[model samples]
Target: MANPTFWVAVALFIFIGLLYYYGVPGNVGKQLDSRGKRIADELAEAKRLREDAEKLLKEFEAKRAAAEREAAEIVSNAKEEAERLASEAQEKMADFVKRRTASAEAKIAQAEAQASAEVRAAAVDAAIKASESVLRQEITGNAASSLVSQGLNDVRAKLQ
Candidate 1:
């Protein structure tokens, strides 16, 4: 009872007894359990949010793939339409060229026929003039008149 070690041991026992009487250890244990439950709830919420985000990502990916397919289909249809238009244009050009060629040939044939008619008319006039000059130089009086009239009748019959 007079020793310092004995006094220190007695003081430590009193402090432990006071802590138990005040319910300090039980309060600490309850606070630790509440903190653990809060942490578990937060982990569960995080897991649920992650699953929701994954589902949204999958939906967006499916939408993007559908959009790409639709775009490709539109491009393919446009290419087909363009090719069809180009072929139609070529066909129209070919038809136009054929019609123009036919028209040009018709005009050329008409001009050739007109030129041949003019040449024949000029030759007939030249022949008539030559025959008139020769007959006037060779013939004379009433006998010559009769002969000229007979020759003119023969030339007219041959021409017809």
Candidate 2:
């Protein structure tokens, strides 16, 4: 035992003699108990952290769902607003077209009335000139009588 092993043997003798005099077995048992308690606390802390993480995940999912619902509602509202605006624009356009058409019709009616009045005035003027020519050409009483009959017939036909 005079080799390197002699030193290891000498250290072990010192350790055993110190344990016998100081009740080192009880100290070892106390150290092991404290280590076990520390291990148990670490496991409990790990479990608590896991539960907190799960709760946070649930909260995040709930918030995401709420945001999605809100976004959908907003989109729906926007679509409705767009449709309403489109409908209003279409209605205004239709009304504008109707008004323009009515105005054009009114102008056409006024033009037709003016044309008819002018035609009637021209017809009366022509009839009066023909009567004057006949009176100047025919002087006999019977010729005058035939002229009056023809003039009356022309006026009646024009009136009809």
Q: Model 2, range 1-160, lDDT digits (tens) per residue? A: 6787988999999999899779888888889999999999999999999999999999999999999999999999999999999999999999999999999999999999888877887887676668657765665577777777787778767774
Supply candidate 1's per-residue lDDT for 44: 95
Candidate 1 lDDT, tens digit per residue, 68-128?
9999999999999999999999999999999999999999998898888677656765776
Cα distance off (Å), candidate 1, residue 38: 2.4
The local distance difference test score of model 1 is: 0.87
**Clash count for each candidate, listed in order shown:** 0, 0
Off by over 4 Å in 1: 1-23, 124-160
Using TM-score as the measure, the top candidate is 1
Q: Extract clashing residue pairs from model 2.
A: none
Give per-model TM-scores.
0.66, 0.62
